[model samples]
Target: MDSRFVGIADLVETPSVAVVVDVMRACTVAAWAFAQGAERIVLAESLDEALALKARHPDWAALKDGPLAPGFDMVNSPGLLRSIDLAGRTVVQKTTAGTVGALAVKGASLVLCAGFVVAEATARLLRTHECDSVTFVVTGEDGQADEDLACAQYIARRATGAGTDASEFLGRAAASRAATELATGVRQGVHPDDVALCLELDRFPFAMVATSEGPQMVLRPCAATSPTDAASI
Candidate 1:
């Protein structure tokens, strides 16, 4: 690993792990999907691909397509996902930027899904390693704004033993400007409340992992050895 930077789609090779982020919607949706009891999420970079996966497993799958225009199954929204029941079922998701962003780093040596919700767990994951370098790839945002950059900086600070103050970092002028932009029109498609939900740290302990079965993303709820015992997070 050589250098670490914000932004997701564009990244170079490294011997260390790469933290993939889709903060605006994808990661948030994944978090909610798990919270609602989804067995797994198959993240496809393309809508057609995700649909195809559903076609293969129609008996037990549903598709959530990102907002492109109007003729899609579902727009990437955590609220919409929350309203549905997915217990013991799987979700096939396709997002314009997030899913594609994850696929972009398919060749990396180590790739892990991340967002503000699992920031502490992400820090813990980083603590378990001692590589020469680590990169947190913040997808969708081009690094000109605070959302992804703030998250990237947060991860980098964790990796380097530096302090992380999220609100302060996001309170900068540039970030405020971006917030204005997001409010006016460019990012109106995103839900502010859901964004806040995704930023909450450590509501779950499971790290969303991509596997052959699908994107097995969910909180592996603590298990109690016996009926009288309490479960731990």
Candidate 2:
């Protein structure tokens, strides 16, 4: 199998599987959501759009990050995510990086979200796919972030059956600007605990897979136990 990393803007390859890496928070929040039993996640481009969807489905959880827009359930945060119950509920998420990149992917048969927390599990799921190429879409603000690049590399290596050191990748991610913001509280209102939460590795045994449902991109948890839902695209 061939594996390589590409930024969101450079999504030119029609890979068998595409893994979107937003390790700083977005994908991490998604992994956490699935781990907490969220029924599914909806990716929206803007706060207004997310709010509109929420208005239509009040019971669905609404969340947005990057300045923390109003008229939503909470900021895209894992600490707060842990406090809220998401079981059997559809979650709508708007982010500058993660969700946008996820929705932008048109060449991938199977789309997935990843962070350090679930990087390995995501890789295992990728291994289950019967294909020859995989792309890791680094969905950073500028289409590239140190944390996201490191994560993509780590996941690619793991999925390709190559020995990799997780700490090296985790350390590179923790040193990213986004991680620094969380630690220094530069990103006010977002908890510092989020830094630790997102950095912690291998938290789940399932993969968060996204599929297009009409105009909406729905993300659901897929167990990495075999060639299950994620392997089918």
Candidate 3:
């Protein structure tokens, strides 16, 4: 699928590769988890749900979630995630935006997860697979424009591998715009580190997928397991 703009509602009918973008947090965390050697990750839409999952499997997973400002065990800081030991461990994470977006794309034909951190890799996956269509679902802020749109702009370019025109500039433009938004008062607390984190390209080789186990949504290694093997993660 060539890169194109899309909405959260449109995700239901899109018969193509679905790349869920939650740049500020969720997707960023997924990339970090993979690099940290997390065997898999689970993205729950709400902190309460994520906590319950952790309670049920206390011996097997590490949990993280909470409001963004004070931060949580599963804080959205990309810097902190790098120091944690995740190899062979399962992570149950909850966030305000990204995980919710993953929940919405649960039934996509090919639900591939993405964010700024893996833009290059995401593009590679698209070029190699060349699916029927490509939809960049921006889980907007409270259903309004937020950092996800900027992240989506970058992913859209990567998914199509389009170099001419502004395809190459969308990501940079998005980040610049996000910076502008932060400065102009439309958005606040937009971290420079986070904006930079979202712009990093293809730092890892894997894309994440949201796995469903009953009512829970978890981010898992897309290449490592099938949906039927949800219990194993």
Evaluated with lDDT, which candidate comes out highest?
2
- Rank by lDDT, highest first: 2, 3, 1
Model 2 weakest 10-residue run by lDDT: 224-233
Clashing pairs in 1: none
TM-score, candidate 2, is 0.92
Model 1 clash tally?
0
lDDT of 2 by residue, 52-117 (tens): 999999898888884555678778888777777777788999988899889888446888888888
Over the stretch 98-201, how does candidate 1's per-residue lDDT look in tens digits?
Answer: 66656666555555666666665566556555546766666654645456666666766765556767665444422444345544556544555554555565
lDDT of 1: 0.57
Name the regions of candidate 2 deviating beyond 4 angstroms: 227-233
lDDT of 1 at 106: 59
Indicate which candidate wins on TM-score.
2
lDDT on C-alpha atoms for all candidate structures: 0.57, 0.81, 0.61
Minimal lDDT window, size 10, model 1: 221-230
- What value does the lDDT take at residue 209 in candidate 2? 82
Off by over 4 Å in 3: 2-4, 9-16, 60-72, 142-147, 164-192, 211-216, 222-233
Show pairs that collide, candidate 3: 41-219, 42-218, 42-219, 43-218, 43-219, 64-74
Cα lDDT for residue 188, candidate 1: 42
Clashing pairs in 2: none
